[model samples]
Target: MNEREEDLRVPLISFLLCLCVLIGGIFLFLYLFVPNLSEPWFPPIALILIGFPWLLWVLTYIYTCIKRCFGVSRNNTDSNRQISRRASTMANSRMARNASTTNGSNNAKEKQAQLGSASLNSSHCSKSEDPSITSSQEIEMPLTTSAPS
Candidate 1:
């Protein structure tokens, strides 16, 4: 209650003081130009002086009202950016998970290929009937040396 009252008091006092000043200025103008009141230029100048501030205030009020209706603010955009950033992060993490899964499957396939080749070698060795060709014997291959530098 006290805070609200403090907030209202300053603007109320400032507005009253401004109103007093405007009215004093008008009164002074009237006293000085009483004889020229019938001049064609007086009414328009006086009306504009009095009406312009009110016109600006009405425009400002309407602007605020429209802004409220549209529900636009800095916080909304910041939160939306945060949400998009989080979604992108999640998508990146999911892609990483998928890539790791794919790599694991590829490794598993390589292990299966190695095991099948090993089994084929074992079967070929078992089918060999020659006594000279034993499983433990290692065939030697000649290595060609690069031409003498």
Candidate 2:
């Protein structure tokens, strides 16, 4: 409540004060400056019909200008989102590059692991075969297996 009072109360009070003053000034002008036509209400009514709408247009233009200056426009929001997305993409790419650069042993370890796995598979295959091992073990195994079956 206190914060709302501080932020909104003062401004709202000032706005209402100024609006009252403006209405008073307009009434005084219409009463004094504008000459009364033959009819009692025509001149005052004409001023209201013309000046009030024109005043509304001018206020609308000023409001749009202020909104643009504050960066609350739609284009500003879309552009800010585009910038944020690009920044995140750039951050991810930089992290990937940094990781690859700092870890020099990663490639060597990967290659060693792959070679060890291949040799382990060959050893398993050889153990499963129970025959007299020869120098031409691979050739003999394939020939014997294919010839019989």
Candidate 3:
């Protein structure tokens, strides 16, 4: 068998063995102590015996799930903070490089000033426009059907 399957085999076999033992013990206990199955207390006692282990297992599973969720969220927040730091550092370095390059060139400065002014003008134009009318309404395209040759 493969390494992964071999690793799983031991745990799987142990779990099956434990289950078999549990079932055998329960049956043996019921047979030895409770001969009368129809007794009022027998059913509740049997149910409790069977359900208690399952209840413990379910509670354990839920606790693990809650722990996993918190762990994942914690990891995500840590990763996000790392990514934000990296991005900010990269942006700062790029800005520094641009500043250094622009110092030697008048053309670069002129281009930067033009881009800034263009952005300002665009922002102003957007602010002056009526909010009720959308860009889609301002520009309309005509629909045309292709004629078969």
Candidate 4:
């Protein structure tokens, strides 16, 4: 009932009518002109009639896939711009935070210490890395042996 649905309805109905006309015309031609056609010729003629629409649909699908792979869609371009904008905003926020922290009168040694500690604390543990173990110091392992029979 809405404008969008009504717009789609007209085109859809027209397409179906055109398809019906095409199929009907093909059958009518085959019936009239190929009345004495042999069995061997019948399958090829029928296949050609049926396959035209199928071929068109397949070609259209492939064209759309190729276009999508090449990033020709407007929606894809819009999403890329949005992603870059968000990344830039995050970087700007981080820069502002760093500027605010270093604005104090702290000397080089104190500033370096504060920055180092902040970095160490701010670093998050990834899913694959354990948070409980902080140091890279190697641990001694006990040697395993089979019990004497």
**lDDT (tens digit, per residue) of candidate 2 on 1-149:** 44434677767766765665566556656666775623456446556644664676699899979978985666665465445444444444444445445656676455445444543343233445342232234333221111111
**Shift in Å, residue 70, candidate 4:** 2.5
Error of model 2, residue 92, in angstroms: 18
Segments in model 1 whose C-alpha atoms lie over 4 Å from true places: 1-33, 36-38, 73-149
Backbone atom clashes (below 3 Å) for every candidate: 0, 0, 0, 0
- TM-scores, all candidates, are 0.30, 0.28, 0.28, 0.31
CA shift of 90, model 4, Å = 14
Q: After superposition, how far is residue 135 of candidate 4 from its true place, in Å?
A: 50
Worst 10 residues of 1 by lDDT: 140-149
Top model number, TM-score: 4
Least well predicted 10-residue stretch by lDDT in candidate 3? 140-149
Q: What residue pairs clash in candidate 1, if any at all?
A: none
Residues 51-132, candidate 4: write the lDDT tens digits: 7666777998998799788856756644654454444444444544564566654554454455445433333224464422
lDDT at position 71, candidate 3:
58
Model 2 / residue 50 / CA error / Å: 1.9
Model 4 worst lDDT window (10 residues): 134-143
Over 12-101, each residue of candidate 1 has an lDDT whose tens digit, in order, gives 866865775586557557746785554556556666656666676799899989986787674675465445444444444444444555
Give the clashing residue pairs of candidate 3, or none: none
lDDT of 3 at 144: 21
lDDT for model 4 comes to 0.51
Q: What is the C-alpha lDDT of each candidate?
A: 0.52, 0.50, 0.52, 0.51
